[model samples]
Target: MAKKKNKKASPNTIGTNKQARRLYEILETFEAGISLLGTEVKSLRGGHVSFKDGYVSFHDGSAFLVGVHIAPYEQTGQYDQHDPERRRRLLLHKHEIDVLQSKVDQRGLTVVPMKMYFSRGKVKVQIGLGRGKNVHSKKQDLKDRDIQRDTQRQLASYK
Candidate 1:
């Protein structure tokens, strides 16, 4: 009889853009593959990524991820490492890109990167179509979140 190989448990999520959620009202989300170099992939696996100010831009009928930072892999030589803040190409179908571009152009909405995760051994990005929220709405969202947290705490205590 052959022995079974043990599989290690690991989380699929690499990082999330919490600021994007707090600043924008997300309307729709689409999953797309990100083009990354080897060192970038290693850094992502170690959770060394920042999504601050990350957004998607359409150019010549293709979408690109911008403003995101993937830290350089420390174990690799300097020359072998990838840029920490380079624009990455996103793999989306032509029709999907067209739809997002149309929404951005016609509705004045923004395309932001919501999260990045590994799916079936491939890295995937979750992009959201969002409208920028005003200061008052952001404050309201904070208040509502606090209220919901308090209610959940009270319910848990009662139980």
Candidate 2:
């Protein structure tokens, strides 16, 4: 008998924080694993998560995902329900944590959760270090995007 080979599948995105991209100019991003309870995982699989006001925070040499809401698993018993707004720990190396902390403390950059997805069988969060964009910058970004879209449309029509 021949041994079987296992193939890896592409990651499945659970949710994204669109507001973060629009409101902040991302400078750097890091992928970190998230700690979740059984019910939380189930709820996430069911696409019951909100990224509103979600961001990363460092404390005591550890990173945490805060202000994100993961809805409770609907079929779970009341006793087994998990808190929807708990601050979950983010799994990152000591060096990575230190780097993030330093950047935050020194540069005054904010760490926000950009995306959440399942890589292999585990959940991962893509955290971004960013500075908040001013209103003028945000408007300029919108104008640039509109111009890019018009150019693309004209080129597509020519094709």
Assess each prediction's global lDDT (C-alpha) against the native: 0.93, 0.92
Off by over 4 Å in 2: 1-11
Tens-digit lDDT track for model 1 on 95-117? 99999999999999999999899
Winning candidate number (lDDT): 1
Best by TM-score: 2
lDDT of 2 by residue, 74-105 (tens): 99999999999999999999999999999999
- lDDT for 124 in candidate 2 is 93
Candidate 1 segments exceeding 4 Å error: 1-10, 157-159
Query: How high is the lDDT of residue 90 in model 2?
Result: 98
TM-score of each: 0.89, 0.91
lDDT of 1 at 99: 99
